[model samples]
Target: MNIRFLAQSEYFNGLHLKDDIVLEKEYEQGPFTNLPKVRYFLYYLEENIRKEVMPYTDKVDIFNITDCQSESDYLYFIEYVDMLDRTYTFNIIRYNITDHTHTKIISLKDNLKLYPDNKQIKIFILDDSNLIIQRALPKVSENGKLKEFFDFSLILFNFVKNKQIIIEDENLTRNGIEFILPYSDNNCIMKTGYSLFQNNRHANLTKEEAAVESLFVVNISQFISDLQLEQPNLVMNAIDQSYYDTTVINAKLIENFLIYSKFNYENNDENIIFYDIETKEIYTCINKTTTGEYLLKNATVIEDTPYMIMKNSTGTQFFNLISNEIDATYPVEYNVRFVNNNTVISTIVEKNIFGKETEVVCIHKFPIKKVILQEKGEYIGCVTSDKETSYIFLK
Candidate 1:
C-alpha cells in the first residue's frame, strides 16, 4: 500500500485529509531557525519504507499541497515574500513521483492584491491547471471611509494555459459571498449572503434576523465558452436567484440534487431541503430540534457518492438523495469523511482513563481496520484512503 508521510518521528495510520478551501496567512519575518521543520515523505506500507518527498525550507512562507500520491505526479504551491521589495511570490511546483524531481510550472510575483492593510484573501487551487482566488474589494465612501458593502471578485487563473476569467457582479458586491464550491467537474456554485456568527448571547439567529438571499450556480466551462465567443452577457443574463428565498446554508451539490439546510424561525428547529436541479422538485424535511449547530460544521455531502451525512443536535443521519430515504442513522461521535456504496470512512474519538482523547480512523468496509496515531496533535491533518491505497497525514 502506498502512503504519503507528511512528518517524521511518529506514524499516523489515517487517510490524508484534503481541504478544498484554502485561506492565505502571513508568517513572521526572519530566519525561523527555532521553528520545527515539517517535511513530506512517501511511505510504502508493503515494504515499510519512506522516501523523502519535499524538504521544509526556511525561505518558503507557505506551502499548499494540492495533490500528493506515489502513483501520480504530486502538485503543490509555495508562497514566499521577497525580503527586498516586501512582495509576495507564488509558485506552483509539479513533482514527479517516480523520478524524484520537481518542475516549476509557473511563478507569480507581486500579483496578489488585497484590501486596505491586507485584510484577508482565499486561494483555491482546484487542480494543477486551475486556480481560483476570492478577495474582498474595498468600497470607499465619499468621505474616504470604507463602507460595509464591499465588492467581491472571483478570478479563475489557469497558469498552465495562461488563461484567466474574472466574474465581477453587482450581486456579489451588494450581499457579499459566503463560500464557493466545485459543483461538478466543470461548474462551481457560489453562495452569496450575510452570516450571523455564533456567539453565547445569540447562538442561532432566527430567519427574520439573518437569512440567505441569493445562491448563484454557474457553469464555469460554459461561461468560459461563452466568453470565448464574445458572448459574456449570455452567462450573466441567465443568472436567476429569486426561487430560494429562505435561510439556507451549507448548500452542496451531489449528482442532480442540491441538498441544503434551512432554519425554521417559528419552531426554532433546523430543516433539510433537497432540491432537484433537473426537475425543480424540492423536498424539505419537517422541523426538528437540531438548531444551534455551527454552519458548515454539522452538514457535509460525501465525496464521490450519492449520500449526504448530516449531524445535528439530535443525531447524525445518512440521507440518500436518490431514494429520498434515511439510509442509516449514526451516532454523533462518528464523523463521516468519505463514503461510497462499498466503503465508509470516518473518525471516532477514543478517550482513555486519564481523559485523554485520541481520534482513530475507522475503515468499515472493503478491508476493516482501525488506524491510530502514537502522538496526538491539535490540528486535523490530511486524510485519503480508498480501495487501492491510503495516504494519511499527522503532526
Candidate 2:
C-alpha cells in the first residue's frame, strides 16, 4: 500500500475533500490588527500541485466560513468586539461559489435589541433557508457566587426570507443543550443537559448533592418546520426522559441510533449505549473501561457501509452498526484518526532521545489482518479517505 503526502504547513487548522480537490485552511492572527487571517489553498494530488484560493484580507476580529446545506453557496461571519460595553457583535455573509459574490444575511447591528450580550456563539446551518444560532453565557448568582447555571438563547433565522425567531431559557443550569446535529434528512436531535433537584436514578444523595449532569434527547424538527413557516416563539415539546438516563453523559446521532457513553461514577468506568430512535429501546455494549469518557464518530467502510468508532483509554473499537457488534480494535498507543472501506489510518506520538515528541502514521489495510505500512511524519489528521486514496495534513 502507498501512503501519499499532499502538503505540510505550520499553520494548518483543518482539511476537507470536495470531489477531486482537497481544501486546506491555514489560520493565524494578524500581528498588528490582532484579527484572524486565513489563507485557503487547493491541492490537486494527481499533479502534485497546490494553488492559493481565497484571500480574505479584511480586518475583522473573528472571521469564519461555515458550510450549510447548499453546495453552491456558503456562509461566513465577521465578528467584532465593543470595548466600551465589553460585548461582541457579528455579521453573517453569504458567499456564492459560482459567482463569487458576497451578501450580508444577518447583522447583529440590526438585531441588537434581541441579542445584546452574546458572549459565546454557536451557529448551526440546517438547510439553505434555515439557520440556528445559540448564544450562551454564564449566569451569575444574586450574591455574585460562582454557580453552574447558564443563560441560553436560540435564534432561528430564515435568511432567504429575512425573518427570525428568538427563544430564551434563562434557567438552563444543567449544561443547556450541549450539542445539536441532524437526526435525519429532515429532522434534528439535541443532546441537552439538565439537573434534577432529586437523585432520580439513585436516592443516595441529598438535594444539593443531587445536582449531577444528565442528558436527554429532544427532537427539534417541529421548531425547524415552524421557523420556515414564519412562526414565532415556537415551543419545544418533544423532550422525552424515557430515552435517557443519568449514566449517559454525551451522545451523537448515528443513522437511526443515538450512540452515547454511559459512565458509572462510583466504579469510574464507561460503556457504549445505542438507543434506537424508532423502537425506543436501548442496546448496551458492556465493554467497560476505566477511561470514564469516550469520543464517538460515524465512519463508513467500503461500499458505503456504516460503522461507529468508540475511542476509549484502551483503544479504538470499530462497531458495526448494521450487525450491532465490534469488528476490530486498535491499541491505545495508536490513536485511530480516520477509517474508510479499505484502510485505517492512525497516529502515534513518540519521544526521541532528546526528549522531543513527534507524531507518525500507521496504515492498516482491511480487514486489518496486520500492519501493512508505517510512514514517519507529523500526521495530525486525515483530510479525505476512500477506497483507493487517502489525504492527511501534517504539522
Candidate 3:
C-alpha cells in the first residue's frame, strides 16, 4: 500500500500540460461531474491555499488520509501555476510489484553477451596426484595469428606446503601477469618453473685448460714474491718451475696444488722454524744447496767471542768464530753445551777462561717440528731441516 512519485512532464505550445490535475474515486459520478471540471477546481483551490500557506522553498507537503475503504483505490492530485495563468488536465496510474530473481537473470545474460568472441580468455587446470603434467601454449593460426579462444592447461605436481609460485615476464611482447594457484588435490602448478636465463657468459674450462691458463695468466711466482714482501711473517713459497710446468698440463693437478697450498698456509708461522744442520745455527736458507765456502755476513751468531767450529747431532760442520772472551778472540778449545734436546747451545765464560770478564754466547733455532702430510691414511710427518715445509707430508 505504498505510492512513489516519478518525474514525467511534456510541453505543448507555450503551456504546461499537467498545470492542473485531480484524482477521485469515480471521475464521472463525483460532485465535480467530470475530470476537466474537477481539474479546474483543483487549480483554483491550489492557488488560494498556496497564497495562505506560503510553503518553504526546499520542502514539499504530503497529506495522508486513513479513512480510505480500499488501499488499491487511492487517488492523487497535483496543481501548479502556468505562465498565462491557464489550467490543463492529465492522467497517471501507479503500481507496486517487483521480481528480483527475474532482474538478476536478465543482468547475467546481458553481461555474458558482451564478450561473444572470447578474445582474451584464459583457463588453468591442475592434476590430482602426479608430478607429470602437460602445458599448452597459446594456440596460433596458420597465418601466425593467435586464436580468440582461451589459453591454459592442466598442471600436475607434488605440492609444497606454505610456498607460492611467481611468474614474471619483463618484455611487453609477452603477457606479464602473476597468479596464485592454491594447493588443491595435493598438487600445485607453477607458471614459470625454470629460469629464462640459464646460459652464462663465463665458459667452464677443462682440467688441462684450467691448469695451463691459471699458471700462465696468474703469475704464481710473482704472487708468492708479493706475499713474501708484503707479509714477511708468512711462510710462503712458489712451486718450482719444473713442477709448475708439469702440473700446468692438467687442471686436476692445479686444483690439488691449490688445495694443498691453502692447507699449508693456514697455520701460525711462528710455529715453523728453520735450522742449518751444517752450521748448527738458526738461519733461513733456500732449499737448494750450493757448493763452495759462503760466509754469512751480519749472521746471528751464538756467542760474543768467535769459535773455531760448531757441530750438530748429525756431525755436520757449522760456523767458525773469530774472537775470545778476553780480547774478543775466537774460542778454539772449549765445546758448547745444549740445555735441552740439542736445541739451544750456550757457552760458559768463567773468570779463569777470560781473566775477570764473564760472557756467554747462545744460539736459538726455528721451532717448526712437524709438517702435515696430505695423503691417504697418514695425516702428518717430519721434515728435515734441509727440506721445505711444503714438500713434507704425513706418512
Give the number of the best model, judged by TM-score.
2
Q: Estimate each model's TM-score.
A: 0.55, 0.63, 0.12
Best candidate per lDDT, number?
Answer: 2
Number of backbone collisions per candidate: 7, 1, 20
For residues 1-395, write the lDDT of model 1, one tens digit per residue: 33333443444433222221111222354533432223445554434465655554433433323221222345354534455665556565666555667767666564333323343344555554665555664444344432332455656667779887774444544555566655555556656665432222123333333323556566665554543453323444322242223345466655565666665444666656666665767655544564445233333344333454666765557666557777666556766555433355567778999998887655454223333322333224444344334433444
Model 3 quality (TM-score): 0.12
Cα lDDT of candidate 3 equals: 0.22
Quickly count the clashes in candidate 1. 7
Candidate 3 displacement at residue 78 in angstroms:
99
Model 2, 1-395: lDDT tens digits are 34576556664444444443556566677432334555655666556667654354332434223343322234354534353464445666665433456676676642333333435566776667777776666554444433332566667788889888764443233345555655554555664554331223233333343333433444445556655554433355433332223445556644466676655555656556666677767655554566544534543443434466677887887777668888788888887777655688888888999999887788887556366777778776665533566766665
Each candidate's lDDT (Cα)?
0.49, 0.55, 0.22
Clashing pairs in 1: 15-383, 15-384, 16-382, 16-383, 16-384, 17-382, 17-383
Please list the residue runs of candidate 1 whose C-alpha ends up more than 4 Å from where it truly belongs after superposition.
Answer: 1-53, 56-74, 81-88, 92-117, 123-133, 138-149, 154-168, 172-180, 183-185, 188-218, 227-248, 251-258, 264-267, 274-283, 286-291, 294-395
